[model samples]
Target chain A: MLAKRIIPCLDVKDGKTVKGVQFVNFRDAGDPVELGKQYSELGADELVYLDITASHEGRKTFTELVQRIAAEVSIPFTVGGGIHELSDVERLLAAGADKVSINSSAIRRPELISEIAARFGVQECVCAIDARLEDDGQWRCYLNGGRIPTERTLFEWAHEAQERGAGEILFTSMNHDGSKQGFAIDALRRLHEELSIPVIASGGAGTKQHFLDVFQQAHVDAALAASVFHFNEIPMAELKQFLADEGVVVRQTCK
Target chain B: MVAIVKYNAGNIYSVFCACKRLGYEPVITDDPELLRSADKVIFPGVGEARAAMEYLNATGLADVIRSLKQPVLGICIGMQLMCRHSEEGDVDCLGIFDAPVERFRPTSAVDKVPQMGWNTVSANGASDKNCLFEGVADGAYVYYVHSYRVPVCADTIATTDYCGEYSAALHKGNFYATQFHPEKSGSVGEQILKNFLAL
Candidate 1:
């Protein structure tokens, strides 16, 4: 059985985690390595570090940050944001990332996914899609921190991503961003019904029941949250226990 | 000294890092002489079994590994390749253990194919003391990410439930294999490595 995953996403800017209420009004949270180690100790299924900074700072700092976090935590870590090519993937893997996520690069050159998949295997490649619900009731693909919209539709992009050999799809809803109402259940249901690859549902998880709704109703493999976890609105172990009570098979923390 | 067999697998760095954490310097190489001369050999892999076996046979490390008399530990695909045969490539294995690796068949309503994430293990009663599960509890959870699994056999030291009861840890004389990745499994995983090192 594939156990449901609980991932805490940390957005790093200038090597410091900056959490916002709704992708705006940023506030300094803590250090990346310290937060990663804390999450590992708290039994997080996985940790995702996204470099939210878009400056021309040298790559040395980000690679060093990855190394520092990998040294502190023994669990699987994924690094994303600013990965442009095979060399970027190689650098992060060499720096100790278990997986590399590509978003805008993948959108620009879909072949990059296949190339990386062939070299490092599909399990190492994760395709992140940020989709926003259009006024016409269609999901449009967004990139560059949900600032730009591509002409591609969600289903088309997801199917092509899988065809290009992505092991998993990380789907984040723009409309649900920091809404905390719940996940975009309709979009998730459509993706789960369409694609065979493992789908990780992100964005808009306000309460414990929201997680339950996503896991039970949406049938997503993993659920990711940022503010909820960073602000300690919900304890991970307790959430796992709650899911377990709901008959969802989650990785229980060793007592 | 610890020698980790390097055959283009993904998890070699984690294994090397784990050794460093244990106060031991491990050499990652595919050379036969270095592997045979090491106090213990760590066979770590994260790719397909056929390709790994192909690399071993091409490098002539297959014969060296089969003839090694010291303790040897196989991790993940390394463990799968130690069996009689693997379904991944229909390739013959090292035959260190009498078991055969089979693709997981999802019978229940749950999803099929890759069985990822963590699960608990229940030890077999044959051994009063388990070498890998020394400090680990009976139902402790360990991280796993694989599609195929080895069937339970007489050599199984610990069993975990996924699609069904599968071999979590297997032992035959001095040869040991684990389907889970101890290097990525946190504190309990570290203790398992410590037990392996203490051996």
Candidate 2:
């Protein structure tokens, strides 16, 4: 059986992790490679590093950081944020990123998904959707890291992105994000039932139960969290053990 | 020297990085001579079979790859292409292995087409002694991401059951292939690579 994945997402800014990620063992959250290594050791199945800083110099630093992490960390890692063109995708892949996640750029130009999928295969491209539930009981998609709103609905955009050759969908509920309440279970389940590709649930992960609920109830392929892992609030190894004891299948690793 | 066959496939850089992590500076090349003369050749792939074969054939690397005398390891699509044929696009592949690749048919809704994530892989028959698996414990988890798979057959060395029992690793003489990516599989992966390098 394929094990459910536990991913630790790092929001990078100005060449350092900007999410106030302070590990108990490692005081500094700035070094991506060190943090990535620690997460991998703690049983993180994958890592997602989003370069929130969209500057040319920031990109250079992100690429260098990816190279350093790739050398030491054995698990797969993804690089996202500011990926607009095919060359951007190519550059990241060449820099040693296992996959590339596109959010605002993909929403603006859906064709970019097929282009990258055609060039680098579908499995390498991930479509990340930031969404918020409106009063109409419908989820509306957002752009620019949830600061801007779009007319497109979450279901419609997710469907289009998959047809355009996105291998997986990373759905983040803006309402749930940073709330530490939990994931948007109903929304995630609806998306999972609709899409043929794998659906990853992000945003609003407060406890190990949150991960369990998303995986068992929502049926998401993976669960991603940031601050909880960064601040050592939930030790990754302990979380996996908790999930495993709760009857969720996860990859067991040697520390 | 370790040479990774460069045929416009995906995840080639990850393979290169894995080699570098093991303290060997590998070269990525498409030149037939370079691939043939290397101590070991790693054929990494993550692209369409038809297009990849087209590139290999056009560049004459296909013939060179088939004739290489050194130990050649194929990863993911690289492993599929080594088979007699693939149903992905009804394209013919290098007939190094006797099996054929088939697209996975999900038995249920939860059985995703592209089985992505970590899964335990166990050796079959004498594969426990197969140099590629040396120092690797049985049932160790390895990372795999693929939509199509080669059914179990004579060349099957290690097996992983996802949807069904399929070829996780295949060995026939000097040619070895794995549907899983050892480079992306962490510690168990590093051990597998070290075993391959020692070979």
Candidate 3:
């Protein structure tokens, strides 16, 4: 059985971890490599580094940081933000990222999925969909970090992303994001039922129960969070232990 | 010195880092002479089988890899290429393990193809005595990300069940391979690599 992953997302700006990181041991919140090392040591199944502003200069810094994180953190990690082309994926993979998450670029050019999957294996590409619940009772996809909304619905685009060659679908509900209410369980279950590939449920994880809820109720392959892990509200090792006690299959050993 | 085969593959850097963490600075090279004289050879890859094999054949590393007498370890696509043949691109492989690679044909939609994330691996056959496992537990969770799988055969030393039971690790003579990425498999993985290095 594949263990359900608990991933801590690091929001990178100018190559440093930003927003809601407070580890007493590490004084530097902006240092992604430091925070990432901490998380991996705590037994977080994986880490996701999302470069919010992936400018040309930022790309260089992010790549360098990826190399550092790759060396220090032995666990697998996924890099996202500013990944527009196959070359970008190649650079990051060459730098040592286990996978690359494509969001806005994939929304703009759906074929980019197949292009990267062709050049680098499909397992290397992760299609991240930031979806907002619309008034019409449908979930619409968003771009530019949820600033611009697209006509594509969550189910339609996610299914297409898989058909195009995405190995996993990372669904983040804008409504549930940062609300700390829990995962968008209903939407997560819907997406889980729709796609054959593994689905990673993101957004609105305040407590350990949130992880347990998604793993038990929605049956997501993985659960991701930022502030919950970064702010130390839910330490990865404790959260994983809590989930394991709840009978969720999680990696127990953390060094 | 340990030498890692450098070919048209991905994530060789992480392998280098893993070895470095274990206090061995592995030499990443495609030169057959360097590969043969090394204390150990690590055949690691994360790319398409046809392209990778083509590069090995073109660079003459294919012959070098097959002829290496030292302890050799292949990973992911590297392990697939060591098989007799692969259904992926209908390509022939190095034929070291005499196993065939088959694409994951999930019987139902609920069964995922790539089988990504951590899964438990158990010792199989006489390979339970294989030193590669060493201090690793019987059902240690190792990282896996692959769509193609090698069916259970006589050479299979370790097995993991995803859509079905498949060879997670194979050993024959001095050659050993694993479908999982020990470099990215956390502490259990580090110990496995340490065990391999000690061999």
Candidate 4:
């Protein structure tokens, strides 16, 4: 059986983990590579390093960080954020990333998805969508990290991305995030229904039950949480054991 | 030294890194001489069937690989290409194994086309002799991300149940192939690679 994936996402700025990863016992808390290795030991199914760096030198550092992680960590990982063109995609994948995620660049130029998928295959391209359920009851997609809203709605853009050859969709809900409530189940379910590719539920993960709700109710292929896993609020091994007891198929740490 | 077959496929860096992690010196090369003379050859790929076969034929790697006397391991599309044919591009692949690759038909809502993430691989009954699975538990979890599959055959040493029983890894003489990525499969994968290196 295909086990549902559990992913821990990290925010990287200048090749360092921006958010306070309070739970890590590693010597250097800001080093993304060390944190990633720690997560792998703790049984993370996959890892995503969202590079928020903008400067050219910072991008180079991110690439270097990717190589270090790939060489040291034994699991697969996806690099996202600041990926604009095919060259950027090529650089990261060449640097040993299993996959690359794109957001605002894909929305600005939809063809970027096709270009990456054509050269590197669909499995290598991850389309990340940041949207918010606003007034008037529409899920409006956002850009620039949920600061600016786009005219494209959630479902419409996701369908287009799938058509344009995105193998997976990482949907982050702005309204439900930081509420300590749960994943945006309704929107995630709709995305899975409307698209054939895998859907990764992000944002609003507070408890072990939240993870179970997303996988059981929304039927998403994977669920990603940042702060909870980082803060050790919900340990991965215990969570997987709980989900398994609840009849949810999760990849347990190998014996 | 280990030689990794390089073709038009995307980066084979992960495979190289995996070898290095195992304390082996590996090189990514398309040279026929290096691949033929290496202690072992790793055929890793991530691309379409037709294009990959085309590149192999163009570079004469198809013949070079078929003629290898040492153990050769194939990963993902590399495994599919080792079969007789593939439904991906209706292309005829190298006939190393008797198995044929077919596309996965989405039977249910949850059966995603690309069977991504981790899944279990169980050693077949007679697979006790195949050292590639040495020290590895039956029904071990490994990472997989592919759409096409090869049905269980005489050469299938291990099977994984996604929609149904499919050949997860096939062993025939000196050729070994895995449908999943051992390099990306963590410790279990490392053990499998160690077993392969022991050959």
Would you estimate the TM-scores of all the predictions?
0.91, 0.97, 0.97, 0.98
Error of 2 at A100 (Å): 0.8
Residues A27-57, model 4: lDDT tens digits? 8879998899888988999999999988999
Tell me the deviation in Å of residue B12 in model 4: 0.7
The DockQ assigned to candidate 4 is 0.81
| Model 3: residues with Cα > 4 Å off, grouped in runs | B124-127
| Model 2, span B1-199: residue lDDT tens | 9999988787888899899989999999988788888999999978899898888888989899999998999999999999999998899999999999999888777876578789988884553557788878888899998889999998898998987888999999999998999999998998888888778
Write model 1 residue lDDT over B1-49, tens digit each, in one string: 8999988667688788877877899999888889989998999777778
Interface RMSD of 3: 0.9
The CAPRI category of model 1 is acceptable
Task: Write candidate 3's Cα lDDT for B45-68 as tens digits.
Answer: 899998888888888998999999
Q: Give the Cα-based TM-score of candidate 4 against the true structure.
A: 0.98
The iRMS of the candidates, in order, is 2.3, 1.1, 0.9, 1.0
Compared with the true structure, the alpha-carbon lDDT of candidate 3 equals: 0.90
- The CAPRI-style docking tier of model 2 reads medium
Worst 10 residues of 1 chain A by lDDT: A20-29
The alpha-carbon deviation from the true structure for residue B152 of candidate 1, after best TM-score superposition, in angstroms, is 1.9
RMSD (Cα, Å) for all candidates, in order, is 3.3, 1.3, 1.4, 1.1
Q: Which candidate gets the maximum DockQ versus the true structure?
A: 3
Candidate 3 colliding pairs: none
Q: Each model's DockQ?
A: 0.45, 0.78, 0.82, 0.81
The CAPRI-style docking tier of model 4 reads: high
